[model samples]
Target chain A: MSGRSERVRGKLSYAEAIREALDIAMDRDERVVLMGEDIGVYGGAFQVTGDLFGKYGPERVIDTPISELGGAGVAIGAAMTGLRPVFEFQFSDFAALAMEQIVNQAAKLRYMLGGAVSVPVVMRFPAGSGTGAAAQHSQSIEAWLGHVPGLKVVQPSTPEDAKGLLLSAIEDPDPVMIFEHKLLYKTKGHVPRGHYETPIGEAALRRIGHSLTIVATSIMARKSLSAAEELARQGIHADVIDLRSIRPIDRETVLASVRKTGRLMCVYEGVKTLGIGAEISAMVAESDAFDFLEAPIVRLGGAECPIPYNPELEKSVVPQEPDILEAARNLVQGRI
Target chain B: MPVEVIMPKVDMDMASGKILAWHVSAGDEVSKGDPLFDIETDKAAMEVESPGDGILRFPVDEGAVVQIGRPVGWIYADGEVASDPPGGIPSSKDEFRQSVPGEATADGSRNNISSGPDNISGKFRASPLARSLARADGFEIATIVGTGPRGRIEAKDVRNYQARRESEADTSDALAVSESASGTGTPIILLHGFASDAKSWTRLESNLGQRPLVRMELPGHGRSQILKAVGFPDLAATVRQTFDGLNLDKAHLIGHSLGGALLLDLANARPDLVASLTLIAPAGLGPEINGELLAGILRATRSESLGPWLKKLVADESLVTESYVQAAMRDRMEQSTRAAQEAMADALFPDGVQAFDLRAALARVEVPTRILWGKQDRMIQWNHALRAPGRVAIHLLDGIGHMPQIEAPEEVARIIEANL
Candidate 1:
């Protein structure tokens, strides 16, 4: 394990890293099974779970009905019986159909049961839009799940993180929801091909800077980093944190970084109103971190309107790197 | 030798037990079955007996949560005899000396910290001050190595280096902007997208704030002269004449979407007028445009019709306001605006496929180009934005979609500001 950590090599896409993580986890634990729609024979819509069915066989790599609710129920049931189950939603948008099973049941089961049973379930969902999937298939709704009390929500931006966080989620005794961005699936990053874990409820500092701390999740993390690069050209260093897990949020990591930077900008694909940004902003406000903030916590997100079909209008709705960079500039300059 | 003591699992649901009380401190000798400490679980508080007859070393303080089957305190057995039963407690030093491989080290080094650098990539670390300063100054730490403690770089180093470079460049930029202001150069013109008007450029316009600026709503978009029937070429012609009407041969053209596509067409048709082209995730590149979003833009007669569709463009839906949707529908209601949207949607994206492939057209242009795209662009993939002319530079902004110029106007302005 130590040898693998020291052996840094070429770049790998986010998809490859996730696959490697799944492969290692399955190999290490026989009880770890992956079940979802088209996950077995189809290898998933985005191909994030490519070719797992053949290796793990039908029992471990079970494919359920077209029902998102049914699949979630099955996973939850399996978890209650001592098996570790990883459920996948064809699209995160479909999670709305399974809200009762997820928010009401999977999330509250362990806590409400007086800790008698542990829900070691990991549900993976493809979230966000960029492929012209439009309103039905697009949308970033992780904030909704994060709002649930007992659920642990995670969004891994990088391949290595996808692998580490997935392993961690599998090991956790409580239910964990993993929101994977559609655009990031094909993106590659180097990943260790062994059992590893990134502790849940911790944020990873992707890029270090002081002018402003850009707290982002899932695909937004990549955008924040890109904006950080652009900001660097302008002589503004933006510290970026990938809040991998939304619920059980690593408040310590976010607050510590914000305390140093004195400025905070929360970026995400979700709408600004009642979105993840609001929660983060409130978290900062409620903590001592608020005193350290030099500027108001700025949130860069999708326009509060329906995503337009016109290519031009669609581009205008969501938060972009240029938007992030510009927001950072304004915050650093006290413009906002 | 050090002996291990673990919090007993008092109940089945009890995952972690807390240390309620400690009877002895470090260096204290202990015998088998000695009452070491009191543990508290979700059920109740119970006394825990020592595992070995040795010096006690309680690492965790009272009120620390410990997992079952995991050692919480250590004891030195010295050379004792085996007497305690398996379920009773510890017996002798040899009996307690059984080492569990891969268990946490006795030094408490592996607690809470990361297990190891398993899949983490690259050595991207810097001091908190250095990171903040670097971000503030827009410096990329990956390009520089640290010299501080543990090879971590400090913010002062970044500031010193940045100050030197900015001073050298500030002199030249000031002189150029001043020269342009003195009538040596023409004003910059910014074009807004459909349903959006000149106000979209307010952020960037204010930033370039210095140069004389002219912003117009395209025939079907803002307050510009509305058109009856508009297409890409028609919009391009109007934009070209708009520059002509302003009495300027060529000014910097910064456009978003329809504006961007129009600018590209104009730059291709008359390369001499355009000093540079800044395209914000412009269309006319890919054939895989989202038809549903386009249909929503055209059929949206009211906010109810347009709200959900508009929200699809961004990951966040709050940006979609009833007023914003109403304004979009109102713009589309205009006879000319409706025709223009229909014609452009058909001409640019015909039957769910992009009709125009401007890569070849852009290849013939010689103007310096800068392309900006949102990674989350739902209408046209950022991949299409990369099809600029050979010399054109591309910046893919994540979390944005087709109309980053509006969703992130300030960002569009900053990128343009940097280019200027």
Candidate 2:
């Protein structure tokens, strides 16, 4: 029924898709460069870069010292001078150390310089919990960068989108931030061969239904899709929207779905307070879709606390598939 | 650059404002501080003044729920070419407007209710959508029992309430039919056309005095219950049951349009109950029908849109009075009644093609049958009367449209008397 399912060739893990994207970009353009801490020799903290360092050599794939602020600044400066730099954060939590470069410099350089110099830099963040990395290393801080206007933030749930969106992010003129959920790196799915760009700022409709709309971001989108499958078995169908991008949010897709389903539930792994769910909930409330809501809008996000070291506590910190199932069932059955 | 007209932040805590109405349309010259539009905030509805004098170009339609400080329109200065709003044109302009009628007024009521924690103030805990649906369908939300968390009223609750109310109305109507059947002689049962009720036969009924008369309201019309019949046979059976319930051995059946088609089916099914048949511009003769006119009537929500179609029912437009238009509008006000009529129209006449063939029903008639047609009838053409058998009587009235009863009541009454 969907053209996306028909276009697939073979299966690849989400981590492999990112590696292939970097390989294709480097071969296509000499201006493309990779910069990060332990990305060259150690083959990335999560092994996403893999043997790309050996394929591209050290000149193209350069590893930096343990200074995120300094490394990010250098990448942003190289982007202004025409080189396409793909920077990876060892963990998304360390993005806090480079906030001065990402938030102020990379986000506002072009607008501040009267649109003379464009930043074509792409940053990959290994975000989310369930790895027992504790609060310091395992955190989803994509929302912080997403709040900045000049930056384009994306979270690809599927391997196809991971490859397609990464390629597109490399091609984007503005500084793009790609938040790769650590849990989704090993998950495998059919990835379309060659260079394909899943346009950023557009939300993908994973499942179509009329009972309600479930808008989920990053890894939460995967969990929501599974929950939707269970809901369908119970005769409670929901439109599952995988919000691949968050910065230039897909307001139209979300609004259109909410209008059809007459209910909305935003599921994300970010902190519940001012996370992506809050923005989405507010966006619907302020749009015409508000009138179509049959039930109260729901938000099932990460608990308002740091990620714990214990595996059980870590799972409880963020929303799981069961959480999505219960919330969707309640919203659709009008229990909430 | 044109001065951008934004949805002003009226209240300190207001996140969005709904533009109730645009006082000035596009391309209108406006001065600074002139009333451009009225916006409804959470607290109150207030008129927002124009920021600069220019030609107002509303990129956004009225009733749009816009975020505070977002530009809803742009005021182009003299000799300055117009441009799109910075936010670009919204794909669906009127999507946010309330689908319900008579509730668009800015009466300080919440223009758009939110499911937020702050909006919960009434005795019930209904969802915003549930409240809107109930209000639109003319149901009091307080009366609806909630099935949501903490006894919150959900949209499904409102829908269940409507279904229960319709069934209750149906039961009372059945009682009224049996109780009202008190006449002595063979009764003249009159059935109305599609989208019409028993009240439509009032003009013809007054002329048939001293004769036992029974005005039967078809399902989905007047006070009758809505019947979701499978086919024409099922619809005919329903009318037949109503006749049988009256304890009448036989009835002189008179039907018009859709009603005529049903009576023909009834006579074909149970010839004993039908003493005689008077079909007036009835459906089922051919596939041809004025489906556009039928659709226009069903879609019309106000008198202005409905009056034109009602005027086509008669050759003389004067017969389609203001009261007639208002009466039809009032009938359509009930959501269930309108829905039932639409379902019937789609089943009987799909895409203007009559779904049934009653030529055999007319040919196999054992009893006396009369067909009335108007020369100026624009609904079902008069040519259909030519299909009638030689044994049947055919009367084609001059200067008349679909409705011979309203245009030439005396003539229609005389023809029915001849059949009797």
> Would candidate 1 be rated incorrect, acceptable, medium or high by CAPRI criteria?
incorrect
TM-score of each: 0.45, 0.54
Q: In model 2 chain B, which range of ten residues has the least summed lDDT? A: B95-104
Worst 10 residues of 1 chain A by lDDT: A288-297
TM-score for candidate 2, residues paired by index: 0.54
| Overall lDDT per candidate, in order of appearance | 0.72, 0.81
The worst-scoring run of ten residues by lDDT in candidate 1 chain B lies at B110-119
Q: Compared with the real two-chain complex, what DockQ does model 1 have?
A: 0.01
Query: Model 2 - which docking category?
Result: incorrect
